[model samples]
Target: MMFRQLFDHASCTYTYLIADPVINAAILVDPVLEQVDRDLKLLDELGLTLQFCLETHIHADHVTGTGKLRDIAGCLGIVPQGAQASCADRYIQDLELLELGKVIIQALATPGHTDNHMAYMVNGNLILTGDALLIRGCGRTDFQGGDAGTLYDTITQRLFTLPDTTLVYPGHDYRGFTASTIGEEKQWNLRIVGRDRDSFVQFMSHLDLPDPKKMMEAIPANEECGRVSVVV
Candidate 1:
């Protein structure tokens, strides 16, 4: 397997490119529109064909590159079923397995940060936790129908249950840190470490974060797979 973690400094977004060595069939998760050229360059340099672009949810911070990449790479776009993104070629269900060459990526429904968020389980060892779980802190649950209790349950019951050694690759990280493990997060994640559901809910309820700068544009653009203007 070949793996690369690409970052968009502007939005603090992490895009993952994973490929199977046998055929160079690859899939990209959480690609940003501005980074399409860079991602395409990487694919070109590696001689890999993009088979799919997977979106965890309809992001509010930055526009996703799903449609552009699909048009350029001739790949399919997939999002969680709950995202209500008709622009996607298809929507994945929980526990559904998507195959890229010899590699299999399984989608896990772990909603909280958003009503339809999903974390991808890849090859049994790595988890791409979109925004449900971050490096040392979890995603803010102040909007998009976010619920703190659900996020708490997601962390403790769904994500924490994985093997302690499972690698965690988050969707976004403001800090420069790269990756963490299930055990590391469980023991040290400030938001979920020592708090119960109620406390966690209370903690998240007061975040008071300002809305994303690009929300007004990004939300509508992203729903159509990042087209600045959707004709249809």
Candidate 2:
């Protein structure tokens, strides 16, 4: 298995490339629209055929590259089962496994940041927590059907139950930190460490974060699987 983490500075998004070198097949997770060329080049240089472009959820920050990548590479577009992506070629359900050679990706429904968000666990040891859990902080539960209590339950009940050593690679990272382990976060993540459900919900309600800068344009485009014409 081959894995690479790519970053988009503009939106602070993290796009992951996971592949099975034996079969030369790759899947891009939470890709950014502006980084399509870069991702394509990387895939080409790696001698891999892109078999899937997967989204964790319908994003409200950056438009996805799935649609364009699908058009260019003829790969299927996959999204979480309840994501409002009409153009997705497939909707992956909870605990469903997507395999390429020996690599297996399992979809875990961790809906709180968004009503239909998902986190992908790869090979049982690594997790791609798409906005569900961050390094120290978690995603804001203020919009897109977000609920603070639900997010708390997801972190404590679902994700925290994983092996303490499981690697956590988040969808976006504003801080310079790259990755963290489930044990580290479980012990140090201030957002969920000692807070109960009600307290966590109350705390999240007071964050008062502003919407993402691209929210106005990103949501609708993401719903269409990143198909939109820019007026440039």
Candidate 3:
């Protein structure tokens, strides 16, 4: 298995490239549209054929490259089940496996930041923790269909149970904290560690985060696979 983590400075988002050398097949996750040219160039240089373009959730921060990549690479677009993204070829469910060459991508439903959010585990070692978990914190639960209690349960019961050595690659980070282990987050994450459900909810409710600057534009564009047909 081969993987590369790409970062978009503007939105502090991380995009991923996972590939299998044997069959030369690859999949891209959470690609940013602005950086699609560079990503596509890299894929071309690597002699890999893109098999799938996967989205973890409908983003509220930046436009996605799923549609562009699908069109360019002629690959299938995969998204979380119930997320209404235009042109998505597959709607993944919890425990669904996507096989591309030697790489096996397993989908895990992790609804906290958003009701349709998902985390992808690659080869059982690397976990792509979309907006569900981050290095020192977790995603905000103040968005549409977001609930703090549900986030706590998802992290403690579902994600924290993974092996300590499992590498975590989050969807976004602004403080230069690129990645962390599941064990590290389970033990040290300020939001979800060592707190009861009620305390967690209270803490989350008190956090006065400003609404995302791109929310009014990004959400609707993201839902339409990066097109601006309707306003968010």
Candidate 4:
């Protein structure tokens, strides 16, 4: 198993690369459009063939590199079946398993931040949580059909059920913190650690976070697989 975590400072987004050493095949999760060159360089340096460019959800911050990667590298673009990312070549459902040589990536339909959000569990040990579960705070559920109660369920009922030692790699983090264990989050994530549904809802309701600055542009481009403008 080979893995690398790449970061986009502008949006605080984290992109993940995981490959099967035996076959030299790789998958990228939550790719950013502007970073396509860097990702490709890394893949080439490692002598890996790009098999899939996966999206955890349609992002509102940074446009996705799925289409470009596919066009240039001849890889498939995959997203959650309900993401409505019309430009993607394939959409996967909950529990669907994607194989890269010997590595298996399992989809977990844990919606909340966005109604179609999906987290990938790799080999039952590492979880690429996207926006669903963060280190000390989870994603906000105030837009894109977000529901606090549903998010609460996804966290307490689904993610927390994972093995305590499962390594959690979140999609974004504002602070310098990087990587956390399920057990640590269970104990320290103030937003959902000990709060009940109602309390969590109340807390999230008052957050009042401003929408991402790039939301207007990024969301549309992401849905269209990074086409900044559609040609009629």
Listed per candidate, the RMSD to the true structure in angstroms reads 2.0, 0.8, 1.9, 2.1
Candidate 1 wrongly placed segments (more than 4 Å): 230-232
Weakest 10 consecutive residues of candidate 2 by summed lDDT = 223-232
For all candidates, what are the clash counts?
A: 0, 0, 0, 0
Candidate that scores best on TM-score: 2
* Per-residue lDDT of candidate 3, residues 1-232 (tens digit): 8899999988999999999988988899999988889899999999989988899999998888887888888988888998978657889999999998778899999998999999999999989999999888989999868899999999999999999999999999989988899999988998887799999999999999998888998888888888664332
Question: By how many angstroms RMSD does model 4 differ from the true structure?
Answer: 2.1
The global Cα lDDT (0 to 1) of model 3 is: 0.90
Angstrom error of the Cα, residue 121, model 4: value is: 0.4
Worst lDDT run of 10 residues, candidate 3, spans 223-232
Once fitted onto the true fold, the runs of candidate 3 whose alpha carbons sit more than 4 angstroms away are: 229-232
Task: Please report, in order, the local distance difference test score of every candidate based on alpha carbons.
Answer: 0.91, 0.94, 0.90, 0.91
Model 1 clash pairs are: none
List candidate 2 segments past 4 Å from native.
none
Cα lDDT of model 4 by residue, 63-91, tens digit: 88888899899999999988878788899
Candidate 3 TM-score, true structure as reference: 0.96
lDDT string, candidate 1, 1-232, tens digits: 8889999988999999999978988999999998999999999999999999999888999999988999899999999987868888989999999987778899999889998999999999999999999999888887787889998999999999999999999999998989999999988999898899999999898888999987888888988999776322
Candidate 4 to truth, TM: 0.97
Cα lDDT, model 1, residue 126: 97
